[model samples]
Target: MKLPVLVLCLVATAAAAPLALAQTPIDPLDARDVRRLDKMEQVVRELRAIVFQGRDIGKPVVVQPAETDYQLQEVSRRLADLEQTITRMTGDLENANRQAELAKRDAEALRTENRSLSDRIASLESRALAETVAPPGGLGGASSGLSANDLFSEARQALTSGDYAAAESGFREYVDAYGDSSKAAEARYWLGKALTARGAHADAAGSYIAAIRGWPSTSWAPDAVVELSRSLIALKKPADACQTLAEFAKRYPKASTTVKTRAAQARNQAKCAA
Candidate 1:
């Protein structure tokens, strides 16, 4: 009778074992989420099956053995961790999408801005080029066909070919003949460059200063300012050089590389000893 009662108790325990090892359901809408949960569910089912099998192998066994309980708890804890990981991944994907959208918008805005700037620059260049070829509306109208560009090209070619004398002569002629020309400012700037190349620092400083003062809005003004500062330093007038360099940096902060480099050199030379 005692053996039969013990067997009955074991049978009842075995029957209730499967009920104790139940799986938690996961509701996922999207295909990606469905696949992810399917894999997780498979793992959970495997854990449940193993724990239930262990209970059947032992008489009057608990739903999960002590050793099996530890593993099941670990699996549950891992599932919770995976859920948190998925949440974080979803957040990161959302942020990346937002960043990509912002980048696309910013790129479009930059392209529009660049196109506008190019149009403005082209207009200025066209005006400058036209002014270069056109003669002054004065007594010099008869000789209007003679363009400053021709003279400048000749001067530049001569200078580059090491003909300092001819370059100097040509530059002087351009400045005198085209006093009111758009290229006048550039002509004066190049005159200073030519004089400087010929080791005439005093004349170069004068020419550069005149060029910048006469046409502050011209494209050559910034270059003239840089050249003047360098010439002032060479003339041993560091105080004046400092003033010129500081002015150049302040006025043309976004100037050409050559201008910026010269301005830096002038600042170094101008600053006094400690």
Candidate 2:
């Protein structure tokens, strides 16, 4: 009897377990929970699609946020601006370098021209000196035997004969030997004329300056001043030439018509003010 009772109890417990489970209340999901589940489902679908696409294409998967495209665009714009700035700076630097090179070349050209001019002047001076020594037993070689008056006469004769080299040597000797003599100024004037004929304008200017010292009262004084002005003009010193001419009218009021005419010509050459 106990065995039948135990079998019936076991069957009743088994049927009541199902009834208890059927009576339990299940809580439905809220709106927030439903939205969260939907978002998770969409993300899972996208990830699966990306994985499948990457496997098919044999390329790596790259998942970017929504703002990443905008950030990349901003970085690209900044890089473009930087590239433009670098291009402008490079152009400016190249222009500066080109200008500096041009300036350096110009300076070198000017230096070369100046050196050539100096060499030409020195060659002319050497030629003049060589000519002075060329004549056999000429004024310079035989000058020791001649008296001062003889030397002056020979130099004047050489000048009149257009023998400029002998004249220069003789006159140079006369001035050196008799600088304190009465004809010293005249000798210097003649020396300046010979130097001028040889295109030695710088040396001629010095000789003329020495000849016109103290503004002597001789007849040649006005002519010396005019010749000095001419030499100054040759030296590209127009201002100094004009200044020398200005003193001519005041210093030599009794200047000859020939000298006055020469002075007028020099004034025109120098473009002196009236």
Candidate 3:
């Protein structure tokens, strides 16, 4: 049967591909092609002689048909899916960058807030350390921001923490600021203790005496006597030390056992008269 000119033309096009495909066969032939390699090669050569050369050689090559519409549509669908996947990945990358930027800003804000709070705490501590002198103008006054007890406690903490200078400063501030306050006697007593610890026994004696004179009936009174006697001894005033201890019991009739015991020790050491 004679093939139409168009059919023959299609065969000729495939026929021309063999030499080009042989030298550089970029695409791999199909499985069916593997089974017919020799037959396809021989037919291609024959069709090249008859159609493209316009001379009869052997039988012609029966070229395979192009892809059907369904195959082409399936390929288009797969390409579209690949494009959609790439678009989604790009959007996800952008979102991740935005989230990272927001997290960085939040961390920076937290650091700034922490710094501000730390500075405020340091300022409060500095205010607490200022010397307690006055035009009656210190923290012990009612107009003062710090309460008498609060001011006193900070000094006590300094003593507990072994910051003798700060303790002395804080206690003086307490006494000058709130001399009439309930905590005043205790503050003065501790001030003396702080001074004595730092070898300022003369100054310490004055604080103990102030405790004894101003708040004599307070719990610190007998203790003040005990501490005052010690400070006096340190000042090389043994007679005054004996006298202070002698007055301890008469001054604090209901003194604590601790205070009584301490007084007895001081008295014996000073060889005071019973």
Candidate 4:
């Protein structure tokens, strides 16, 4: 009876083991999860040791949470994204700076080109003015057997007679032949008047500038400056016109009433400030 009872008990135990395994099935864990569980178990063991060891041992134990590691990884990823964004912004800023520098260089180049063009135009006008007044046979033929005074007098008479063409020709000839003469400045002034009458304001300005180079105290000096300002105004150079007028009082304080009146008129036309 005892042997049969033992056998029945062993069979009952075997049947209960299968039923328990079937009722509570074990979920399969991957390698990563198994490692995480191992690490957590190790941390728990360390914490248990620290708690059991008592405060008098003075040993410190650090426990890190699995969630804290995930948070650190997320923060690291965000930091990497921010670094990439900053690098892109830095590249954009550098590109903008390069474009600005290029634009500055372009503007400077344009200004230089404009100045060169202006100089070329002025030179061409001067050459044209010389060609217009110079005779085909040159100064030798037109000014032949004529004294400097005679040529100067003829040019003045031609101007008075409203013969601008003849006056311009005669004056240009006189200037070329007797540039060192005392009447050269006067000739330049008359040449400017002829050019102004011909609507060559740019050329007229040039001649006026030459005439007043020394700021001579001659009777015509004040008038020449006034005429220069007028020519500058016609050439659409109000700033230069205003500057010329500003110097009038200093250069010709004792100028005649007529010349002063003309200077004032030029200033008004140029819209110069007081």
Tens-digit lDDT string for candidate 1 (18-126): 5754554545479888898677656556555555565666543333335878889999999999999999999999999999999999999978865664454344334
What is the C-alpha local distance difference test score of candidate 2? 0.79
In angstroms, how far off is 158's CA in candidate 2? Answer: 0.4
State in Å the error of residue 118, model 2: 29
Error of 4 at 14 (Å): 99
Give the worst 10-residue stretch by lDDT in candidate 4.
134-143
Question: Which residue pairs clash within candidate 1?
Answer: none
TM-score of 1: 0.45
Best by TM-score: 4
Tens digits of per-residue lDDT, candidate 2, 1-274, equal 0223443455455447557758997579899998996885566556556655766888766766679889999999999999999999999999999999999999999788656644543454454344442224358523467788899999999998999988988888887778899999999899889889988887777777778777899998899889988998998989777778877987898999999999999999999999
User: What TM-score, computed on C-alpha atoms, does each candidate reach?
Assistant: 0.45, 0.50, 0.46, 0.51
Question: Where does candidate 2 stray beyond 4 Å?
Answer: 1-138, 141-143
Model 3 lDDT on a 0 to 1 scale: 0.72
List the RMSD of every prediction in angstroms. 15.2, 20.1, 22.8, 12.9
lDDT string for model 3 (187-243, tens) is 888988888899988777777766666336776677878988887777787776775
Clash count of each predicted structure:
0, 0, 2, 0
